[model samples]
Target: MANQQVNRDFLFRRLHSLLGVVPITLFLFIHLTMNAFATKGADAFNAKAQTLESMPFLPVIEWVFIFLPLLYHGIYGMYVAYTSGYNGSKYSWGRNVMFTLQRVSGVVTFIFILYHLWTAKVLPDGPSFDMVQQILSNPLQYAFMIIGTVCAVFHLANGLWGFLIHWGVTVGPRAQRVSAYVLMLLFVVLSGVGVSALVAFHG
Candidate 1:
């Protein structure tokens, strides 16, 4: 009875930890899709920007919904990763490589996100469509954005793969191998689309 109780408690904790990733992933997809609108020209991109800015209490809402939750999710994710003993070296070679890539990409994404928010959301001058268009017009900014998009997509895909394993969907060795390859392919394609969109952006 004691052992059973301990097992149940462990499972509960894990469930709580794993469940938080779902909403974060959902938001990531939404963000990526929205950003891809940059490919459609300034008018289209600015329309979306105007819509977001036009929301009532926009600043407060952004703090509550975008910044706060993102900070919490990132901290919590790192905690779970550490406590779960998620050492990539113990996994298959492909999984290990993906794991390392995801972590490195996550750091890059974090830096990119901070810069993006600074330039596009939180600056004292307020975000301007003209300013954004000018930034996008730069080759360096385009390169940074392309790298960030690829990193973000791969990180999300790898996280989903890890989620499957956590949920017991990819249990045996063969299934794990297959899922890893499939997710890698999926992320590569998704990243390609995202990079192309960013590269195509014009004022």
Candidate 2:
């Protein structure tokens, strides 16, 4: 019985990690790339938004492929974060900081996602360049967005390194050290894209 419980927990955690990288992180990449069209100008951004809006079974797609997975990952991740300890006798300071930030950012990202869905996605008028521009134009709102975007991107990128280790993809100090650098670079790149897209709203 005890063994069974342990196995169940192990599987649950594995699923949580898998969902983070898959539909959740992948969706972030695609969503940010779409947003990047804003940098091209209003017309370009509007066209991209139109393309998305015109997709078939949009509600079904968002609920099944995006929201459900994200909801599970976020809720379960919060539980794990609450239960897990953040101390170690044999880890670098950078690694320790990442572990702590991972939990902190997870909570922040969940809140940000809720606010974002309400403000940008579920409103009556639908989303457009002008709508997003108006939304981001407020200085306080702009700062909040910048923080949310950075936290979300960092959560996704850093969660990826943990995903790899949990899945036994990076099995040793040497491999983890290398992957840490690579994933931090990934975090920077994704954050740049996210922040740039947000700022593009003002242009």
Candidate 3:
């Protein structure tokens, strides 16, 4: 019975990790890419946003593919963070620090997402170039966005690295190291894109 319980727990953890990489990560990439249109102009951004809003059953797609997975992953992650002890101080290793950051950022990103959804989606006005520009007009709001972007990007990129390791995809030391560099590059690019979109709104 104990063994069976352990197996179930392991399976749940694996699923949580897998979900981060699949629809969750894929959606983030798509979202950032779509928002990147803002850099071109408001018309470009609005057109992209309209394209998304025009999708049939958009709410259903969001709930199934994005929101549900995010909720599960965030809740489970918070549980893990609360239950787990931080050993980064003792280990003083990069991965150890990253593990700690992963937990911290997960919580921050979760809150950011909730607030963002409320402001952008829940309101009857809906998200638009003007709406985004207005929200980002406040300096504090701009700062919060920059911070949120960093947290979300780090969470996804580092989560990807953890996902690969946990799944035994890159177990060897050399392979793991290479994967680390690639993931770091991915983080930089994603952050750059996200921040640029936000900046475009600011200007």
Give the winner by lDDT: 3
lDDT of 2 by residue, 1-203 (tens): 89999999888988999989888989999999999999999999999999998999999999988999999998998898899787744665878978888999999999989888988888848779999999889898888889999999999988999988998999999999898899999999999998999989977
Cα RMSD (Å) between model 2 and the true structure? 2.0
TM-score for all models, in order of appearance:
0.73, 0.93, 0.96
Q: lDDT per residue, candidate 3, 28-91, as tens digits? A: 9999988889999999999999899899998899999999999999899888889888999899
**Model 3 steric clash pairs:** none
Model 2 lDDT on a 0 to 1 scale? 0.90
lDDT rank order: 3, 2, 1
1-203, model 1: which lDDT tens digit per residue?
89999998677556544643645666666666765677777677678867866889976866766677666656655554465544576676765767677667766777788887786666735544467666778888867877887887887788778778878999998998788789889898788767755665643
Task: Report, for all candidates in order, the number of backbone clashes.
Answer: 0, 0, 0
* Candidate 1 clashing pairs, residues 3+ apart or interchain: none
The TM-score of candidate 1 is 0.73
lDDT (Cα, 0-100) at 187 in candidate 1? 91
Pick by lDDT: 1 or 2, better one: 2
